[model samples]
Target: AQSVTQLDSQVPVFEEAPVELRCNYSSSVSVYLFWYVQYPNQGLQLLLKYLSGSTLVKGINGFEAEFNKSQTSFHLRKPSVHISDTAEYFCAVRAFYNTDKLIFGTGTRLQVFP
Candidate 1:
């Protein structure tokens, strides 16, 4: 079985501060990892994804993640965050070359303050 773990349940940070949302996965098969964000009363939006190619994958909203095969980790990082960045961040993974089912973490709430 494959699972995802989010190190922090909640992260509070002042505006313009750097933030890193830790995520680690356990899988016996090859996997594709992803990061998604959900704002208050909004749906989940894709932050970044690691399908193939480079280890460093960049996505919208100034977010990026590096896929570490050895560590079995895909941590999301933002150099600076804004008040608008406050939301719930999720780490998900899907079995490579398999079903569309996605395994998600418990989620980390990013609370950005002024």
Candidate 2:
């Protein structure tokens, strides 16, 4: 089984500023990681994923993440955040054996101010 931890519960940033939401995972076995974002009154939407190959993965809304095996971390970053970017973000891990189950971090609230 794998577990995910979102280092920050909340991150506030000014509009157009760069932002990073830290996430770390613990697992002896290999795992697939994902980042999802939820806007106000909306369900979680896929932001990016790290299955294999590339260490740097880009996703929707100009968000990107780097997979660091050495640090066991997959942190999400956006160079220029917008006020509309204010939302809740989650980090999830899926162990290869348990394809149907995903262990998710508590979540991080990104508050983008104008």
Candidate 3:
């Protein structure tokens, strides 16, 4: 089965601070990379994806990530994060041919303290 690893479980930062969430994956073949953000009790929303072409991908809410083939990693980054950006971020991966489900990492919680 495909697997993903989230380096950090929690990250605390002040409002308007910069944040980064590291993610790595292990797959036998090519895969799709995705970042999902979950705010409080709400469901997850697609932040960004690296499907094909270009190593860098940009997502909603002023967030972005870079796909590194050599490292098998997709790291999320935001230059400046607001209080609203505080949420649980998850790194996920899907096999190129498998449409059944997505493999997700443990997750990283970004707490923006005011």
Candidate 4:
């Protein structure tokens, strides 16, 4: 079984400031990691993913994450966040064979204040 853990349930940051969302995972076998965002009244959408290749993976909306295997972490970060970036972020992991099902974290609500 695979599981994800979001270190912070809520993150408050001022507009145009750099922000980082912490994510950790637990899995007996290798798994694919992902970051998804959900806007108000909207379903989740993929933000980024770590399938293979480079350890540093870039995502949509100016987001990027680094996959640290030893640490079992895939923390999301942005150079400077805008107010529109406010949304609920989830960290997920699934086996390479299983792409449809995702083990998600509790989710972190990013509040970007003006």
Q: Write the per-residue lDDT of candidate 4 for residues 27-66, one digit (tens) a residue.
A: 9988999999999999999999999999999999999999
Instruction: Tell me the tens digit of each residue's lDDT in model 2 across 43-82.
Output: 9999999999999999999999999999999999999999
Q: Which parts of model 1 have CA positions greater than 4 angstroms off?
A: none
* Deviation from native of the Cα of residue 40 in model 2, angstroms: 1.1
**For each candidate, what TM-score against the reference?**
0.97, 0.97, 0.96, 0.97
* For every candidate, C-alpha RMSD to the true structure in Å: 0.7, 0.7, 0.8, 0.8
Q: Clashing residue pairs, candidate 1?
A: none
Overall local distance difference test of candidate 4: 0.96
TM-score-superior candidate, 2 or 4: 2
lDDT of 3 by residue, 28-89 (tens): 99999999999999999999999999899988988999999999999999999898998999
lDDT of candidate 2? 0.95
Worst 10 residues of 2 by lDDT: 95-104
Query: Which lDDT value does model 1 have at 30?
Result: 92
Please give, for residues 1-114, the per-residue lDDT of candidate 1 as tens digits: 789999999999999999999999999999999999999999998999999999999999899999999999999999999999999999999999777689999999999999
* Best model per lDDT: 4
- What TM-score, to 2 decimals, does candidate 4 have? 0.97
- Each candidate structure's count of clashing pairs: 0, 0, 0, 0
Question: Which residue runs does candidate 2 get wrong by more than 4 Å?
Answer: none
TM-score of 2: 0.97
